[model samples]
Target: MTKITLNAEARSDLGKGASRRLRRNANLVPAVVYGGDKAPQSISLLAKDFAKALENEATFSSVISLTIDGKAEDVVIKALQRHPAKSFVLHADFVRVVAGQKMTTSVPLHFINAENSVGVKQQGGEVSHVISEVEVSCEAKDLPEFIEVDLSNVEVGQILHLSDLKLPKGVQLVALAHGNNLAVANIHASRAE
Candidate 1:
């Protein structure tokens, strides 16, 4: 898995007014880190630096190395609040990762060779994705950035469910024992009709 580096500073003040002032004057993003049996700490990061780190989708879904006041820690982005109109991040949440402990997280699913699929090309069918991400359980070190789904030979009307996917070592899908359908690819009639 890839890691993203971020520099953060301890924040003393709290509440909406303080956060607004911090953003308006200092261009800082108010964030909090909680997890791993440690007390939650309020922190702030430069808006530009935080935006730059978020440009990579992997950073949102993968483990990251955050440097807070010169101390480095392994963490993952748990949640983010965004301004509804401008779509700017209002606040962010970080969860500290503990080594050797199993954690559940959502990982993106990447489709491979969809255009070359027989069902899509020769059969005049479209590939539909039911789920873009899947929840999986694994150790922090064994977490994957994304899971790949192959659609080379998928035929029309074929549905690929969660149970059909092959998970990597140390990773297991978090779902009911009966296994709900997590459609990776589905062949639908083309729109030309």
Candidate 2:
């Protein structure tokens, strides 16, 4: 898994107005880090830096080391609020990650060999992704950046479910724990249009 380090500062000021000032005047993004049995911390980060990090696909699932006032905490992006009309970040929520403890988080799914899949290439079918991401539980150290779904052998009218995914050795899908075998992807005949 890819690890990211984000530099932040402990913010003493609170309230929506303070957050607005941080974003408008200081050009920083306000965020909170909670969970992992530790007290929540309010912090601010460089908006540009946070935006740059958000550009990386791996940032969502990857563990981020947040450095605040010389102290570092391991965290993952729990939620992010963006501006309504613009592409600017409004606020962010991060969850602390404790080592040796299992945590659930969503990871992107990568469909490989789709172009060469039997359903698409041989049968002239189209591949449709029912879900782009899946939630999984695993120790912080065993967390995977993304899950890979191979469609090379999938035939037309075939549907691949969550159980079909090949997860890392130490990882388990959250959906399976509750007996939900969600559809991940499928290949079917293209429309007549």
Candidate 3:
């Protein structure tokens, strides 16, 4: 598990005006920490620090230690609002993580052996990643950085679904539990003529 830690300051100044001032003058991103048994807390993180933490894809799925006002809390990235064109994070939302509690969050999917898969190696097929991520429910300790999809034996025209995935112990696919077996990826026959 990749451990990530973020240092933040509790934000007393709230609302659009204060947020704008923080971003313009202090280069901070306003965020909220909610969930668990406590009331929501308003906080602000340095824009560069936030961006740097975000540089790691695992930061989204792994448990992050957010220290606010000298106290540390475990949280997961919930929602992020970004500048439409600039693509920089504007506002962020995070949900507190409890040790024994289960949380629902999306984790990136890694397609392994795609180039070596029988379909691509001998059948002239290409791997099509229909989905890049999947939502899962698990404890903070069981949360995975990524789920691997092995395509070594997949044949051409074979479609892999959510239920087809081999999940780690304690990790459950939200869609599969709800009876929605979504298509994950597939090996499509090459169209090259």
Task: Write model 1 residue lDDT over 1-193, tens digit each, in one string.
Answer: 6778899999999999999998999999999999998999999989999898888878867888989999998888989998899877889999999999988888889988789998988998899998898888899888988989988888888998888787899998887344765566688878763
Per-residue lDDT for 168-187 in model 2, tens only?
Answer: 98999999999999999999
- TM-scores, in order shown? 0.95, 0.98, 0.98
Cand. 3 TM to true fold: 0.98
Q: Residues 47-118, candidate 3, lDDT per residue (tens digit)? A: 999999999999989999999989999999999999999999999999999879999999999999999999
lDDT, each prediction? 0.88, 0.95, 0.95
Looking at model 1, the pairs that clash are none
- Misplaced by over 4 Å in model 3 are none
- Model 2: ten consecutive residues of lowest lDDT: 1-10
Which ranges in model 2 have alpha carbons more than 4 Å from their true place?
none
Ranking by TM-score: 3, 2, 1
Alpha carbon lDDT at 124, candidate 3: 89
Which candidate would rank higher by lDDT, 1 or 2? 2
